[model samples]
Target: MPTEKQPVNFIESALETLLIEQNALKILSTQIDDRFSQACEIILQCKGRVVVTGMGKSGHIGRKIAATFASTGTPSFFMHPGEAGHGDLGMLVRGDVLIAISNSGKSDEIMMLMPLVKHLGVPLITMSADDSGPMPKNADVALTLGHLQEACPLGLAPTSSTTATLALGDALAIALLEARGFTADDFARSHPAGALGKRLLLHVEHIMHQAEELPKVFPDTPLNEVLYEITDKRLGMTTVVDHENTLLGIFTDGDLRRLLDKEQQFNVHTPVSAVMTKNPSTIKAGMRAVEALQSLRDKKINQFVVVDDENKVIGVISMHDLISAGV
Candidate 1:
């Protein structure tokens, strides 16, 4: 028979763990000395990509650090130390920077790879608790993460040490990102498949309804004809333009609803210009889709006209298009 599990106080346990990690992070902050600056300098000076490597728990942290660097405009990748001793060592080049992570500073796999890394004339940066450890002594710049007791009751698991290492890695990555003048658009290019990239990289031109697909009406067009354009284009709105196709105003579902609610009798022969909102919200074709979305959200409106420098309607954008494009 399977053993019956007792109900554990999970929330309390989680809080305690968080408190311990917070304390550990506070301790780690005090040790940011000259070594940290040295590491940053080495990375900033590198012409080639950053190569991160470690063993076990440190390996996991190294992978995250490599990913953060890569996404933030720094070209970087993680190399397994054990595998590096095999043919993987070929990945390291002369101008590259190597970041080795080990809390104990005695990981044999890392030590074995250090000489080959040195022989390749690459700069090495090490993160370890012991400044005198073999890896740190061999490195050109040593960032000491310092000693913080594990949050684990037994003091055996990685715990606080890994957390400190990860934090230090994040600090390095972000600092370098700012130094390199990395922008949101640059980050989006690296992460093109995700929602963040869609928000940063997508523009009005990519999602707006253009040409004949846009719901538009001439100023002299009948009010009922404008209704037909709105229904046919299915954007819940239509733009009013003049003889030159210059945007004049917009008529939306809200406007129609209000008109109907007020019981206003409209002559079918009347022009739409009489009731449309003049100089409606407009966006440029090159504007980011995310910015357009925010504009619509702020105004509590669902549609905007994409206009040229002369204020001529080039296209139309809607909340539905932004949603469908994952912006």
Candidate 2:
């Protein structure tokens, strides 16, 4: 006798779906091999952009993949497969690499554009599950997906399959990033508006006090004059410099407290150099502000002199400046 169908248990179905998808990813990882390396090499050799294209669900994933690649150092963008046939294919050029995503490897829109892509001499890297499909057969490098059953109970929607495709795209992008020796600075340059960008790209010069705004005095300048500079500039410190503006040392509010604690007097006639801390922390204008902040914390100091290569103080930065600059 034929068994009766069980009622759908939504919670159990959801958990099962998650399990299947995660398992599918594990299976997909095992399939990565020489073909993956070949694809990365082709992308590395590409002087032009990585043009990612696909249809439907694959297209959505392709957009994210394109964004990931662009941010991580590879120049890439998503192109709609349907749009490719409608004159958009003109955007692709020689030296470009095409990353085509189609779960079955036989998406009509992607397949139709393959001929033009090949004619343009663009290296094709295909991501798909169907080995028998013509798309993988013709690829310069084919990233094959492990054949896995869909997480959908009815085996209809692309559940595990799309997850596997997305994983493969991430794998390719990150591999290429490592191959290019992509760095945090490179990533920050591409994402300047983000917090990490500000931290890495905003250097000491951008936030430091410059020119007349810098609280400064010569070594022989009276302690009273140094106090006026620190008070007038409101930076709570002054750079002690030579007549040629070379950084000799620094004087801070903390130094004032230590002096007062010792009951030191004869304030007005005291030479600034007599009490100034010599060889104080200094940073170059070109160093990132976040690094400057780390230096302050490391040395237990609140401010740093921004110097030139010749070690002359051009500017000064406080912990307040780095905090204000979002470093």
Candidate 3:
């Protein structure tokens, strides 16, 4: 601890810590050998969840690793080793796989639960600094983090070791994700309220204005009436359809501005079809909202006329609507 009497270089200290941890992660990458693949193989064949257990700082990292696995298609959860010694050992079932994290490979709390875990026939996977300790000796697959040089000035704290462990955990989780052929859509199903979920799961029809809420007009409708429809709907645009409700074109507020600039004598009584944009890009009602947003960005357009398979107008989807829907 630096006092007011001594000058401290905070930037230098932080940079040193980061560099040390980064090197530890680099070393950890090389340590990924046959044992890593064996662990993944065991997990891939598991019929039950992955139960993660650790103590102290390792516990915190274990929880995060378990969460990543859970969200990425693998079923996983964390169990406190200390708590497992009491009644929580029941959480470990026969088909489940156990991932024990202990930098020293000899956490007393974790070692105490090994007998019960083994009796349940759970395949043990251990992460530690090396494969020399009891935890790794008993594991079905021992993932060694290599020899890490701690960033702590006293070399008493777990710095580089924990960072390397986290990196190794992420590597393992992603390997399983790829092996399982997990997709973005699959990930979205597990996170329906997240941004990615909204983008993938929310469709055009879910957020589009339909029925009377859509601003639509016949091709022969007067320009002034089209502006009224646009304002009434507050969508900044209106679809121009024929008598059969088959979309012919679209008219927007921007068209009004350009019409004013081009025509010396503007006539609000003129047919909107004469000034409307012909064959505007349209989207199906079932299309994903994110696809609509991508189209908007690609074509430099703000909205789409939602149409059916027969090109009949069903609804209208706007950029504002997509944004509001959290797509």
Q: Whole-model lDDT, candidate 3?
A: 0.92
Candidate 2 segments exceeding 4 Å error: 1-19, 149-155, 264-266
Candidate 2 lDDT, 1-327, residue by residue in tens: 999998989998889999999999998988889888888888888899999999999999999999999999889999998998999998899988999998898889988987788789899999898567888888888888889889987988998999999888898888878888898888888988868789878988889999989988999999888889999999999999888989999999899889888875657778989989999878789898888898899998788888998989899999998998888
lDDT per residue, candidate 3, 101-122, as tens digits? 9999999999998888889899
Q: Which sections of candidate 1 miss by over 4 Å? A: 1-12
* Alpha-carbon TM-score of each model against the true structure: 0.93, 0.86, 0.93
C-alpha RMSD between model 2 and the true structure: 3.7
Worst 10 residues of 3 by lDDT: 1-10
Candidate with better lDDT, 2 vs 3? 3
Q: After superposition, how far is residue 54 of candidate 3 from its true place, in Å?
A: 0.2
